[model samples]
Target: MIVKFFKNSGGGSANATMNYLLGKENDREGARLLSGDPELTKRLSDSLNFQNRYTVGVLSFEEVNLPDDDKRAIMESFESSLLAGLDKDQYNMTWIEHTDKERLELNFVIANVELTTGKRLQPYFDRVDRPLVENWKQVTNHEYGLTDPHDPDKAQAVKTLNRQNLPKEVQQLKAQI
Candidate 1:
C-alpha cells in the first residue's frame, strides 16, 4: 500500500476536525473519539475549549490498489500500528475512512495533546510514522501471502508487478484502438 502523511495541523479544535473528517466541517454533529479516555465524555466540547492545543495527523493510503475487503482490513492494521508506533499514551484520536476519492484514504486525527509535556509531536509524526506504517504493511501483506511494494529490497514485489497488470484482452483492445 502507498502511504502518505499530510502535514499535521494545529490550532484547530476537535469539533472542527470531526466536521472535516466527516466531509462536514461545519456540521453540528461534531467529532467523536473512537477510543481512548472513555471517561472524557466531552472530548468534542472540551476540545473546542482547547483550540490552540489540539493537533491533527492525516495519513492517506492509496496506490496499493488492493480490493475493498483488503483495504478495510489494512485500515484496522494501520490504526493499531500507529498507536503502538507512537509508544505514547498522549493522544486522543478519531479515524475517518474515505473511499469517496479515487483511492481509499484514511484520515487519522490526533486531536488532543498535553501541553505540559512540553514536547513537540511533529518530529515523532515525521520520523517514526512511516517506518511504523511500513512495518505494518510488511506484516499484514505477509499474512495474506502478498509482498509489500514498500519493503526494502522490493525484489519480490518487482517480480510480481509484471504479472499484476492490465488484462491481456485490455492490452489487445488498446492496440486495436
Candidate 2:
C-alpha cells in the first residue's frame, strides 16, 4: 500500500491530518506552509520512503496557508515526478491519512493505471472507523462468548483451522466433509 503521511494543524484529531493529505486543504494556513518549503517536502517524502516502491504518487496535504497558485504548482510537480519515476502500467497510487479520535478512522483513495490505453486511472474510495482499543476488550471479553464454557480442544481446533491456507468457504466444506 502507498501510505501518504500528512501532519494535522487543526486542533482536531488525526482525522484532520488525513483530510489535509488527501488534497482537501480546506484550511488555508496549512496549505501555505506545505507549498513554500522544499525542505519540508523532502522531509515528508523521506519519512514515507517512497523510493523504488510499486506504490507511486504524491502523498501529502497542502499546508493551509499556501497560495492557490503555489498549491497547484506543487501538485503538478508531484504528479510529474511520480509519472517520470514509475511505469504507469504496473503501479498504483494511494493516499493515507491518520486520525487520533476516540476511535480510529482510515480513508483511502486508490488510483489505477489503464493497461491498454495507458491513461491515468480514476480513484476508488473506502473508509473505516471503530471504537477505541479499550472498548474492544470489554466487548469481546464480556459479550456472547462469556457464558460459553471454555473448551481448550475446541479452541485448539479453531486455531488449527485458522492456520490452514484454505479460504473460509473451502474450510467450511472441509469441516462438513
Best by TM-score: 1
Q: lDDT values of the candidates?
A: 0.51, 0.33
Residue-level lDDT of model 2, residues 8-96, one tens digit each, is 22123323343454435444222223232323322332333222111222322222133445434434444444344455343333333
Per-residue alpha-carbon lDDT of model 1 for 62-151, expressed as tens digits? 443457576557656665576554544554555555555655455565544533363433423656566776666677767755645655
Report the C-alpha displacement of residue 175, candidate 2, in angstroms: 53
Going through the candidates in order, what is the number of backbone clashes in each? Answer: 0, 17
Clashes by residue pair, model 1: none
Candidate RMSDs in Å, in order, are 10.2, 17.5
Q: Any idea what lDDT model 2 has?
A: 0.33
Tell how far residue 176 is off in model 2, in angstroms: 55
Could you tell me how far off, in angstroms, the CA of residue 171 lies in candidate 1 after the best superposition? Answer: 40
Query: In candidate 2, which residue ranges exceed 4 Å CA deviation?
Result: 1-63, 85-110, 115-177
